[model samples]
Target: MSASLYLVAMIVIPAIGAAAVAALPRERGLLAKQVTLGVSLVVLLLAVLATAAFDVDGDRFQLTTSVSWIPDFGAEFALGVDGIALVMLLLIGVLVPLVVTASWHEADAGPRPTRVFFAWLLLLEAMMVGVFVATDVLLFYVFFEAMLVPMYFLIGSFGGPRRQYAAVKFFLYSLVGGLIMLAAVIGLYVVSTSQLGEGTFAFDALRQLDIDPEVQKLLFLGFFVAFAIKAPLVPFHTWLPDSGAEAPIGGAVLLVGVLDKVGTFGFLRYCLPLFPDASRFFAPFVLVLAVVGILYAALLAMGQTDMKRLVSYTSISHFGFIALGIFAFTTEAGTGAVLYMVNHGLATGLLFIVVGMLIGRGGSRQIGDYGGVAAKAPLLAGAFLVAGLASLALPGTNSFVSEFLVLIGSFPERPVFTIVATVGIILAALYILLMYQRTMHGPPRGVLLQQDPAEPLSGTGTGTGTGTGTGGATAASATATATRPAAPGTLRVLDLSRRELAVVAPLIALIIGLGVYPQPLLDLIEPAVSATISDLGGTDR
Candidate 1:
């Protein structure tokens, strides 16, 4: 099949499934789960085929599709895939199925479970695919901004106590940032028309147009600010913690896993090559911000007591690494940054899913609420530990390789920033291990020990009793103890269920697989990155 058909199928399949999920009968909740999973799997398969069909060695956009959407403005329905887009598309494909499985229980939870939750999830998948494959700046922008809607609903409706607030904050922050980007897109379109005698939103065409250095700088800032808000570097990052903390586990996974990459991807795809002079001029300042973000976010992550919030802060720090690589302007660093995008999604998405499971079982997100859970839930604990280790970039894990490459690649160009960013790695160890210790170690506290009072006693002789000597004797003892129960003993923690294991097993395998042999992905990304650097008139290192 043609790549354009595959891309269209990627979008339409999920959208059609979403509609089907919305109409499915509640009694057939299992059907909804199957359909959602089926759609996601198909999308993943298509994305794989798209990757296979992609001409990595060609060093030009592949599967090009264009149609005049607005001829006067030179806007076209342009779509294509480079190596970067291919990687991101693969990520979206991999993550959506995991997210579907993660949220499988939600389909059977409420009175109308199949209708709302599954539908929103499918819609979100469509938007994410659109975001990665779009080639026209306007089309990309539309998908970029359109994503906020499904995400807002996902968080607001299916999430935690603060879901409403988090959703609103996330929506507002992204909306403002996107409006700023829209203005910049318009400016770019207008400038192209004035200078080249034709307006265009085609990325390659815009890249070829020469604008004034001053104007380029201004245009660059417009694009930079928008992506910064999404990348959420430093001051613009406040929304992520709240949103991640409150979003449903699947929602949080995609939010951090896929959407956040749009920011860094923007820098690589548009900012650096299209505005080479401005990118060079702004590199130092952006590197400063990226380094500062690394340290600041790591420190903030260290102080977080909520597991989700801690993970969110860690994302901020990871994105700092991506931003640092982009500004470093080396091919190796840039490629590592791209790799970092995929690795972060896998490792952190696993963290969110595991933490969400912990919350479901323990009934709270407070760090003090859990202790010695590993004693009972050894399998779950082990998975959490592995995921945490990956987050901390331990060797033999996917994150370690990407982070190592990024640091080595950036060291020459931004030594001070690289050195400071390395400290963030140290801090990453502190925060991830500290969180692991608090939740999975020590003794259980808080609500892990609550007992039910209404159950009738059986031969076991617990709770209320039937007529029997032992039961009567125990009843008197229980009454006496009810006045002042002894301090809670060690709590029971259940190991991960087969269902839960199914959700995270693939992620663990990939973490190991990619860590041990990442050459396939590296090979795929290199040619396109080299071309991007050459376009900016830089030597590929």
Candidate 2:
């Protein structure tokens, strides 16, 4: 196959894999899982090859493949990747397999067909890859909206007790955003038709149109609102906590890690280059939202009882940082924003997976239910600590490098906003550290006091028991469990199984490795970011 087909293969392999997995015998769930994982690894290898073939100094978009589709609309099945898209592809490649590994037995938790769950995962992977790779606005929009379907099923069919509610909210929010974007997409095409005597949805062609400043603002708002809802900044973020808390762990990882990035990616890819004047005009307002989201979400995270909900809030806060970097109008901040996209995926994905493991052992998602988890499960505790530290952007974690770059780069252009945003780092420390202390550092409490809790526990759903009972005997038993020592046969929390260790090992390596040396990723990201800044005629004061 031609090298240009690499992106095509990346998308096709997973799609075909999904179909195959879905075709497996009902009893062949194990085979279905193995097949899905194998397919994902193959996609990862292709992503690596695509990355290796990408010349840093080459054309702005690489591995491009185009074919005409809707002639009347001037749309084509065009796909390509810039440094930003390539890195996202790499992130998608890395996370999907780990999710598969982490959620190895997630399907068996319900009477839902195991093959169907894995199939949705593979299908979702394909759509996510398409969203990043598409060079045509129409094609990108299709992938963008199409993504909701598989994820809807993944969450609604295979997720926790509140899955249906979460799924509907996620679908509705995304659908509304997509519909608004559709109007903007149509308007953009109309603008192109008037200027060029024909319509085109090609991203490169559209970006060059000399749209009126007033018109740009209108178009900008449509796109910005869509992305904001997707990124889920502040008020638009209400749906995420529910979705994250209710979805399966694998679904939660992708929901926050990759799906949410599309919103920020849209800001960088569409809002900036295509609407430069409007971008500058609206920068201050966008920054206001960004900083507000950071502080607000951080405050909310500190108050969460469900571990998944807390992690989701942290992502909304991190996205605020990404938005700040993008609107800062510096190559450094843009690069940092793009890098943060990848690093956030690594750190947050690992955090979700590890938290899922904790829920698995304890049979509960409530933070108060877990105490001194470190004592009972040292390896699990160690992993959670590492993930928490990374989420807080600790000095030697991957998040630190990206977060540092975003702050310093944005400071000069928007010092007030930058300073306000900086306070979020302190808030992040409070939330992350407090979460760690409450869950892992105290004496065993809640479900950790149950005998053989891990045996039938599936961390993907609602926990088995509520430790908070009004009964005197129950309260006394709980008090006794917390005060007294754990007996050899009582309240046993399992350490990280070898399979779980294998799952998180790569993410831990990347978190530490990239923390130490982010230059390689920066090198790959800088050129495209620079080109984007150049399109806007450099930083706006």
TM-scores for the candidates:
0.92, 0.94
TM-score of decoy 1: 0.92
In model 2, the worst 10-residue window by lDDT is 466-475
- Which prediction has the highest TM-score against the true structure? 2
Give candidate 2 misplaced runs (Cα > 4 Å): 448-457, 463-490
lDDT agreement with native, every candidate: 0.81, 0.87
Model 2 scores what on Cα lDDT?
A: 0.87
Can you list the residue pairs that collide in candidate 1? 372-441
lDDT digits (tens) for residues 102-195 of candidate 2: 8777666654777998999999999999999999999999999999999999889877668899999999999999999999999999999999
Once model 2 is optimally superposed onto the true structure by TM-score, how far is the C-alpha of residue 242 displaced, in angstroms? Answer: 0.4
Q: Which segments of candidate 1 are over 4 A away from where they belong?
A: 107-112, 449-487
lDDT of 1 by residue, 1-541 (tens): 7766788788779989999998997667778888889999999999999988887677478877777887877878777888888898899999999888877664333223556778888998998888887889999999899999989998887666567899999999999989988998999999988988878899988988988999989889988988998998987899999998878778889999999999999998889888899999998889988999999999999998777788999999999999988788888888899999999999999998888777655445667667888887798898899899999999999998889888998998788999989998899999999999988888765444322222211111111211111112343443333233224854655566666778789999999999999888898887777778887776477
